[model samples]
Target: MSVQKPADPESEWLRQARAGDTSAFDQLVKPFRRRLHTHCYRMLGSPFDADDALQETLLAAWRGLGSFEARSSPGTWLTSIATRICLRMIAKRPRRLTSGDRAAPLRSTAELGEPVEGAVWLEPLPDGELADDDDPAAILLRRESIGLGFVAMLQQLPGLQRAVLLLREVLGYSAAETADMLGTSVASANSALQRSRQTMRARTDIGEKKPVDPQGLERLLQAFVAAWESRDIAAMVELLSDDVRFTMPPLPAWFDGRAFVGQFFAERVFQTPWRLEPLRGNGQPGFACYIRQAGDDRFRPGGVVLLSFAGGRISAIDSFIDPVVCRRFGMRDEIG
Candidate 1:
C-alpha cells in the first residue's frame, strides 16, 4: 500500500487551486465569499443580482487564478473583479426613474396584512456581514457606502462613473491606483472621477463627504414607530416637518405636506392590528410590518418599509411588498 504525504495547506492549496483543483479552489475562496457578496450587493443594489455577480466573480477568479499575479491583496483583487462585473451588468440594464416608479401609491394601510405581489422592497444586509473591528473609519465608510439613497443615486450614474465613485470615494483608492486596476490611463480615471462627482452632486441630495449618525437616526425611527403603533396621529404629525415628503419606489404616487399624510393615516392605516419588527435595511433603519390577516392567528409580513428622515421629521417612506425582498430582510413567515 502506498501512503501519500499530507500537503502543506497554504502552498499546496494555492498550487492545486491554480492547477484546477475544484475543492482546493473552493477552500481558498470560501472565507471571503460573504464579504465579496456584500461588496457586490453594495455595488448592484439587489441581493439577487449580488448573488449572481458573486457567483460570476468566483467563477472568473477560479478560471483566472493563474493570472492573479498577487500584486494586490486577494480581497482587493477580488473586489476589483466584482466591481467590474457589476459595472458590466449595470451597463447592460440601466436603471431608470420614471414618474411611476414610486412605492407609496401601490400600498394602503389596510393592505398591510394581505399578501401583495410585485411590491418592490429594499432588502437588509445581515448584521454578521457588517462586522468590522480594526478601523472605525472603514466601518463607518462601509455603512455610508450602502445607504439606500446612496445606492439609488449610484444606479443613476453611468457604469464607469459608478465604479470610479466607489473605488475612489468608498474604497479610498487613488486615481492612479484605480486607473491601474481598471486598465485605464490616470488622466481618463481622473476625468471619470470628476464626471462622477459632478453627476452625484447634481443627482443626489446626500453629499459625498457627509457623515451619517446611525444611532441618532435609529432613535428617530423608534419614535416614529412608537407613534404609529400607538395610533397617536398627533405625535406622528409632530414627527413630520411641514415640507416632509413620502415616496415608495416602484409605485407612482407620493404625498407631500402634513395634511395629506395626516389624512392618509387617519383614513387608511389607523386602528389596524399592525406591528413593526426592527430591521436594518440599506444600512439604515427599517421595519417589517406584520398585519394581522382576517380570521387568521398568523401575522404576515405585508411589506418591508424603509424610512428617510430630515430635519427631525420623516422625509420618505418606501414600502416594498416583494416576497423575495421580505425574505432578504430576514422577516419570518409567522410573526408573534
Candidate 2:
C-alpha cells in the first residue's frame, strides 16, 4: 500500500491567510516574527522604529499575500517585504545616532549639552526580545550580531550596503537571494557586500578583544555596582580599562580614558545618591539607575547604563538617559 504524504502546514496557512483570514495570517507569520523583528532592529537601530517597520511589514504581507508566488520559503518572502519597508523608512529619516557619533569626548562634564531634539538614538535590545533558538551556537551568533557594537557598525554603512550585508552575511542568504530581496542585480549585491565588509572592518574594532570570561565578568559587575551605589569613584575607576569610554546618549557629551571618565563620575555623577538594579540587554550587563533628588525620600528613574567589555575589563559605559529609553527597559517610576 502506498503511504500518504504529510500535508504542508505552511502551504495550508498561506491559503487561509490569502483568503482574508487574519488569524491564519498571524499563524503563518508567527514563526518568522522574532527574527524579522531583529532584522528590522538591526536595519533601523531603534526599537521604536523597528516596531513601526515590523507592523508595516506584516500589514503589507497580509494585503499583498495574493502576489506571493511560492518561489521561495514564506520566511524569505516576509523578509523581502520587511527589507523594502525599512529601505523606504531609512530614506525618509535621518540616520540614528549614538553619543560617539555626535561629538568628540568632553574633558569636563560640567556642561553636558541638553538632549539633541528630534534625533533618534540607537536603543538597546533586551535579551528577552532576542531569538529563542534551541541551539547554543545559534544563540551565540544572534547575540554577537545584536550586540550594540555590531549594530552600530551596521549603521556606518549606507542603507543599501547595510541591507545587502545583513541579508547575505547575517541571514545567510545567497548573493542572488539578497539581490532578489533588494531588487538589484547579483553583481551589484556582491559589490555592496564587499564594500560593506571593508567599511565594517575599518569603522569598528568590535571583535578585536579577547572573549570575556563569565566568572571574571560576574565579579567585576558586582564590584562596580557596589562601588556605584556607594559613590566610590576610585573603586569604580579601578574596574575600568585604561581607554574606557563613557557615553550618555541624548546628551552629546561623552568621556574617554579612565582618568577622564573617573573625573566625570567624581565631579558630576556622584553628586546625587543612586540606587542600581541589575539588568541584561544586548548580550551585555547593565543597570537601571534610580536617583534620589534633594528633599525627595524616594528614588526615581534616572537612566539605564549598558556596559561593554574588552580584555575582561569594562571598555565602554553607555548610559541612556532618555525617558523613552528608561521606559523601553521597563524602569519603575519610584522606589524607596
Please report the candidate that would top lDDT against the real structure.
2
Candidate 1 lDDT score at position 288: 85
**lDDT of all predictions, in order shown?**
0.71, 0.89
Residues 1-336, candidate 2: write the lDDT tens digits: 999897698888889888888898999999999889999999999888999999999999888998999799999999999999999998998888888887889987779888886656888887777768989888777878888889988887889999999998888999989999999999999999999999988875774256677788789989988999999998999999999998888888999999999999999899999999998788778999999999999999999998898877789998988888898898999998
Q: Cα RMSD (Å) per model?
A: 5.1, 1.4
State each candidate's clash count.
Answer: 8, 0
Error of 1 at 182 (Å): 2.0
Residue 151: error of model 1 in Å? 0.7
